[model samples]
Target chain A: MNHKDKQIQSAVQRALGDKGLSRRDFLRLSGGGALLAGAATSGLLYPGTARAVSTNARIVIVGAGAAGLSCATRLNRELEGAQITLIDRREDHYYQPGLTLVATGVWNTAKTLDSNRRYVPSGVNWIHDMVAEYDPDNNRVITDDGRTVEYDYLMVTTGLQVNYDQVEGMSEELIGQRGVGCVYDKPELAERTWRAVDEFVDNGGVGLFTRPRGDIKCAGAPLKVTMLTESRMKERGTRDKAEMHYLPPGASLFSQPDADDFLSKNFPERGIQIHWDHPLTAIDPDAKTATFDTPLGDETLDYDFIHVVPPMSAPDSLRESELAAQEAPFKGWLEVDRHTLQHNRYANVFGAGDINGVPIGKTAASVKSQVPVAVENMIQAIQGRENSASYDGYTSCPLITELGKAILVEFDYDLKMKPSFPVISPYEEHWVPWVMKDRLLLAAYRAMLRGRI
Target chain B: MAFSFVGILAVVLEFFRGWFWLLIPLIVLDLVLLGLFFKRTSGRRRKFSLPFKASIGFGVFTFVMALITLPGITRSSWEMLAGAVDYLSLIGASVGFGVLFAILAFPVMLHMLGIGPKHKPESQATRQSPAPETETGAEAEPSTASQQPQG
Candidate 1:
């Protein structure tokens, strides 16, 4: 044997011995790795691949975000000879899921930043401009740069926009200043939020985490930021010094009943107070006070640190367009059937991601499930056949309770717990879910974008 | 998917698919190293046990995965001295990742290392050995295939 080979063998032997990793352990690990690869390949991890259909249909996808890119990849792969164009002005793709981690100082800012160019498949046209107007009636979209692109089929994946202006006296510029933090999609903003959280953790005082009235993407993020901040306070031996308040717009803490039940009790036990029906009306960043419009009356509370989650809705382009739902409940959102994800009025139009007026599932996990159904339904429409796939509004949230623990909350439109791994209870906190969130989810998300399950 | 063993196993497998880029390469490297080790020690030992080889590969993988995931589990300085949550998370994540990756890499390792049944051409077998094949390498081959290697 060569000296180098002998040395490597010797080092490996020493490591095994030091760790007391027996032959059984090795056998188990090897068998386990083999099982994982086998299971993943055998269509157990996700659904099986279907044969690609051929079509010359012009498909224009709005917004190159998670849902848009995923739809592009899926549609590009599934349909042959199709003209697929993705429209979005933003070049930098943000992993919105990791923003919560970054805001909590658990992840670096760079981890959430990626390029859309990397995910946009070849043979697909990418328009480097945002859609200024969605004219579904004419089956055409006008870009911000004055380009009108007509499509045989339209997929609206323009994710919801945070309205910082909704809260009077509050703006995106105010974040990271005067102890105001907003954990949204921006990595820089998340980092700035982390700086504010860090200062709040060290010098503790009244920390208020606010949730707006309307539906927001990743509803768990605000609660997660609150819990994590409190955890950080406890870790820093400053838990007693901080007075944490979670002001939700409604009585329920979460959408799912079991999750809501668990969180409703969990927050109070953590000593973080909850004020129901208190929607954030305004925030005076200079005065360090937040105004909440409560059922009783308008109440202003002073704060040392505030996590501002703005009221969200479909982008102005989509909302102002004729495509938006004019009805009650889902008004100002993309008007699409919740199950089929196809437009109610326009058969050529489909919606996925947060823009859909679904009762639940404004999450990346929902995108994972919704994109396929939407793409399949679009393909079915192009084939002049009935829709074959339907979305159950499946969404997952790795609700981080602390740095080390989280709850794997998975549910559908019915708000019932559909735990993927039945062994891990959906209500209890566990490290497995936390690890999935911190280390593994980005890979899964990227895989989704590539349409590889 | 119901709550069956296979379903749970699949979930665990899907979880590790995210880390496949890093893991596949790691497993391949380990297999290459092990192949070299087996090649060097082949003559001395009567048989290089597959279980032992698998153990060595898995050990290395688990150690590396633990190292990679540990920093995240204990990223905060306060988490170091805070309580049992950080340490417990480290242990759980290490074991979970280790097992999942090991399961995913074992088949890959077996395929790359050619540890299972292999076919050798009759002409090559005749050229390499004069007498009937009696070595460990010969035993690893299919008996039926050995009789008619070319076929």
Candidate 2:
């Protein structure tokens, strides 16, 4: 046997223990090589060094989120000799989507946070700094620490910035006080919302949840918080004492009609009050009064506890960039072709995740879909080939409608219902969707982000 | 019933050959289902006829394109599964196709059902009428105030 074969056999032997390998077992272990050869023969595997040949091209990826990491890893593998540098301010990469689950005491923040180094590929350089200025004209970006890096190719995955300031007389510090908790604001604060919810239940107080207008990451998250709180309150025998209210800026419970129908019908039965078209405007921590803009005019409601989902917008660096101005249609967001994910003006620039102006819910699952198209087009562009790869804007939202039941809304750019598995209604909360969200999605995110598919 | 039977046949074919031709029957079934959904939900003549047709057409076209390109896509995907590839091409393709279908399908589905932005009564009225010039004058103060931040 060859050296590589010997190594594989030894590894297999260790895994198999004292049991002698049957012919079937041996073939199964080495079947990967046979499949690869079959694929290569069929001209499926693109020929060339698995890495990019452009050694002189310096690629800079902004933000170390799922999209940024996925892009860098792909470029590092495909663009053989190209130098890649990933910039982000945070030392730890938190799976931001898990924050909603964390708010419900389902996941711990520590478990969601991973060392940024784990996601960064070996050959690529990692810069632990945020971008202060993006000058696409000069083909360079300046870091907050005053370091300027020039690049041949740039990929923006800075994601969205949470603006708690948008709410009148509200700041980050005021969160988790006087029953005012926001699960969407900071990853650290997600746990505090749960604490506030628990405290409110103990004190026999009403729990109020509010969703702000505009594009928010994981659009279903606010509802997830409300449902989980209700479920928890029922378990604690406080369902009668604590009235759960969901005040949303939108006219419906969910963007998807089927989901809205399911939630609207089911929640009322569970004694959860949903006030549609009510946007939270102000909060008084001292008096515990929450003010909302209703169609009936401004109404102030008393609440002992509140969970606020703050308004979100595109990152400031991207909003000010030339790419945003050039692509007028997507005004404040990164302007890339909806299909190929290539910048309309700059062929060398690309985007993925929340940074893109695509009219899809900003979630990690959305990033999961965009990452590959962005990588494919970038590789195609580098190799002087036609950028045939396109993105259809697939975004999945794992709406935890209750403690152990979730509704997985998987859709594309057109908002067509696409379930991962055959669902009875697809929009209704079920144990199957919940199990996948709670158990499978995290591993999938980690695997996909690392370019392991 | 015929569409469902064809969909089942397509599924059987897909199981044997792994070609996505199965989606053709499935998509046709979905269109029939959509037709039934509209007929039941709207209880009126279809108002979003163009968008509804476009959604079904787009779904079928995307599925066909996806299936034809499956071999090339699956090759890289299989490599990733075997720990030999790291590009996530297969996952990306699935997601990309899924997203495309969703974006096209949502509006049609919503409009047919008489919910969402398309069916909102006020929005329709606004589309029909040109506001008086005095309305622009009234809105000018807020626009100027918003512009000051940018300047």
Candidate 3:
């Protein structure tokens, strides 16, 4: 190594030494790292049918986020002689899971920031534009730039949209000021959110953490930000100075039965008053007031800080398209079969990632699981065969209870706890899950981009 | 992004205060592991063990990750460090921080202990070897028909 490299390496070693890790701990993690690496490379940890099916079909994918990138990468690998195109206007990719850490001040925004160029595969044609309209009947999409792209098959993975404007008197600009924070959207927003959260935790006042009902990405993030802020208050010796409240849009805080029960009990112990069925309707940032549409009536609460989680749905173009579900329950969401992820009416069209109107799993872990099923099924479609692969609504949310502790809540369609690590309990907070979030989860997310797991 | 000593303490305290039922066992296990580290490292032949090497690698990795994550928190923003939850937080965050600290620092400590990868001279030869031939890269043999007298 060069002198500069050696110096950098030396500085890192010194920093690690300062942190107080001993030789034994290194040995343990070495063993753990080996297992992780082995599991990843062995094709057993997250295995799927990974062979190329030769075809001359043109496949078009919408969006370039986690779901889009993952789907495109896997499709590139699994299909030979196929023209695959990924369409999205975004150039930089943000690791959305790390946004919670960014907002909570556990990690910097860089942990959540990356370039799409790194994840987009070699053979796939990347179109740096967005779809203006979806012509599903004709198997073509018109772009905002006025390009008409025809495809034999289509995959929509556009993710979700956070409607801050839905909340009256609130905009993206209001964050990081007036004790307002929302841990969604861009990395910059999460960073701005930390500023508001920091001021609230330090000064000590009424802090309101709210979550919207319906489907949202990483359902655990709002909870994590609240607990982390509370923990920060406890650490700051300002716990007594602040009154905390959690507004769940529904009767329950989480989807999983066990997790909901745990939170219902845990909140009371933490001195947090739960306001069930109170979904945030509007916010007056100037008055530091929030309006919630509760079961009783429209209640307006004054707050020093409010974590605003906006209701999310498919983008307007897709929601307005014929591709969207036309009925109740999953209205305005991508219309796909819950198990197959294939469009109910259109067999050649598939949905991957958050766009699919599934029961649960709007998180990135769902992307990892859903991508394989979608890709395999897409390949089967290309070969004029039956789509045998099915998705069981697998979703993982590493629900952080505190800064360094989290509950790795992995579940399937039945809401049954599926713990990847058998010893780690899904019901209770554990250090391993926290470490996984902070230290390990991103690597897995990236590997999924390469279709390795 | 400093991953402040205080921020780490908050996590420990939160664990104990939030999940108190699961600390003593973890603490005892960490304590035992620390003892083993000392017991193993005190010997003369301590260089280049997996434990030693992994400690260094993990430490380096953590440092790199922290370098990226630390920008999230500034030194001035550590005012929250003043608060403590219960009596358990005092022991929990402290002990927890201690154990986690040891785990993170062990790799660096191992490196500092002069336990680096010892390279054998033969490994240098491996780098100089020619690229392995792929089926396409292999030269085509002369056709028997072409080698026969021209028609």
Model 2 RMSD in Å is: 28.4
TM-score of 2: 0.67
- Please identify model 3 stretches exceeding 4 Å from their true place: A1-51, B1-151
Candidate 2 regions exceeding 4 Å error are A1-49, A52-55, A325-329, A423-425, B1-151
| lDDT at residue A311 of model 3 (Cα atoms) | 87
Over B1-151, each residue of candidate 2 has an lDDT whose tens digit, in order, gives 0114322333333233323366555667667766665655452334354555566667667766764554344321221122112224334555578566855475556455432222325544344433344432322222233323231
Better of 1 and 3 by DockQ: 1
lDDT of 2 by residue, A28-114 (tens): 867977875664333221122365456567889999888998888778877767889999978777877788877777787885777
How large is the C-alpha RMSD of every model relative to the true structure?
11.2, 28.4, 18.5
- Residue A85 lDDT in candidate 2: 92
Error of 3 at A247 (Å): 0.7
For each candidate, the alpha-carbon lDDT, in order, equals 0.83, 0.71, 0.78
Model 3 over residues A334-422: C-alpha lDDT tens digits? 99999889999999999998889889988898898899899889888888889899998888889877665668888998999887766
Relative to the unseen true structure, what is the C-alpha lDDT of residue A65 in candidate 3, on a scale of 0 to 100? 94
- The better candidate by DockQ, 2 or 3, is 3
Clashing pairs in 1: A32-B103, A33-B102, A33-B103, A33-B104, A33-B105, A34-B103, A34-B104, A35-B103
Model 1 chain A, poorest ten-residue lDDT window? A42-51
